[model samples]
Target: MWSAEDVARDSVRRQGDGLPLTAVGERVAEAAVREQEAAERALVGGTFSEYEAEPERVAGIWAAKHVEWRRVRDLMAQCSWSRYEPDRDVQGSEWARSRAERRQAVLSGHAADLVRRQDERDELRAELWLSAGPSRLIRVAADRADLRPVEVLAQLAERVVVGEDGRVSVPPFSPSR
Candidate 1:
């Protein structure tokens, strides 16, 4: 798909390094692109192929899978404590006025508030897991995703025995029961 202009632009750059195309390099590059396209068609064309996946469909699948992984990361981010709240750490409740410092925007204030709430939520979730244990935690997370908890337990199951149906067999609460 290289245009004549693309060929010329690239060839000029390559030539600047003392490798100018005599009379054939541009043609060779163009022919290589064309040949590759032709091979793609032959490999997946009118002959023996039962189906072909469209690029857009493939891209959509990739995007959805990416979003699923991102959801996992975002869930984990709720627990992130790598840094203190930006303004609170820097200025406390009172504003630190400087000749050049602008007032905090409304949206930024809301985002900080949201992060604070999420930190509290994450703490509660961690406590819930510690009390109910891993099976319950995986079940809650998987239920949120609308997938069976077993799918998630499969991803994190360690001590508990997981059945095909996702039931986890934890031993009876020890003497503490």
Candidate 2:
């Protein structure tokens, strides 16, 4: 069976956005709702535990996923509720509106942090996920330019076909078939 670390790494790759979206409770609640929706969409497995055997790894991955969902939920909530209706502006109301906008701007920055955090988590998840499953050698991007392909590929099998096997093959989900 694949380990939780593998799954966690795969998810990490998807999240490039920063994090720490915790703010007012109402926003938190709305965020939670959004999170549930996203999680529902993401459910290939019944629960994250389906990905791993170890209890601690499962817990860590779940907690990480939860944080990611919560951040997304709050970001959506902020976008939906931040603006006021047009054409109803008194001096006092205008001032309040401006204040609210400022608050949201600051909050948006916070949301960005949360997004970034999610990305961080995504990075971890992506790695874990990749390790747990099979992979094809797509393309290699290395920091050092002079090194030949052999340095990265290391094995003769990595040249053509990808996945756990050395032979060329297509992914099951690929639509070419």
Candidate 3:
């Protein structure tokens, strides 16, 4: 059984454009999604009790709520009067009303906390994506300098300066010939 930490980390790693992962990263990401899907199924079956404390279970619950949210949102988006709540047999303005009610129910209760956490996670992920560029640069530069990436990054941190005029002053790269 994949742990919650594994799912969360792999899920975050799978995000972002142009950030290619190693083969292992790819495998882990695929496994994480599969775990989430299994959790979702368990949630539907009321068999998720054993994993209630797991963060991955929460994420899976959020995923399930998201599916419902989308369906309700789509119903609200439709302009047709022919649209009806198939399950509730609601029609006309009542259909829209029913959708709104269902949307609130789907987004409320524990799901509201999940939404907040998801928002914070998204903000952090954005920051991580922004840093990925510089991290990649550090890796390439470190490789060329025959030094560890952390050493290269630390040297830059200590020596690289930003001027008031917005010019960057990097210590001269004197690669051994």
lDDT on C-alpha atoms for all candidate structures: 0.42, 0.43, 0.51
lDDT of 2 by residue, 5-65 (tens): 3343234223422323343334445445644654554553334445533344445555554
Best first by lDDT, ranked = 3, 2, 1
- Candidate 1's C-alpha lDDT? 0.42
* Model 2 per-residue lDDT at 93: 40
Q: Which of 2 and 3 is the better model by lDDT?
A: 3
- How much does candidate 3 score in TM-score? 0.21
Residue 112 lDDT (model 2) = 100
lDDT of 1 by residue, 54-115 (tens): 43333333333333333223333454523223232222212223211332464577799999
The TM-scores, one per candidate, come to 0.17, 0.23, 0.21
lDDT minimum window of 10 residues, candidate 3: 12-21
Better of 1 and 3 by lDDT: 3
Error of 1 at 166 (Å): 59
Q: Can you tell me which runs of candidate 3 are displaced by over 4 Å?
A: 1-130, 162-168, 174-177
Tens digits of per-residue lDDT, candidate 3, 1-177, equal: 333433443333233112222433443455557557776775566444656554447666445434433333344345332332333323323544555575578668569799888898865221223278888887788788888876665566567789999999887764321
Model 1 RMSD in angstroms: 23.7
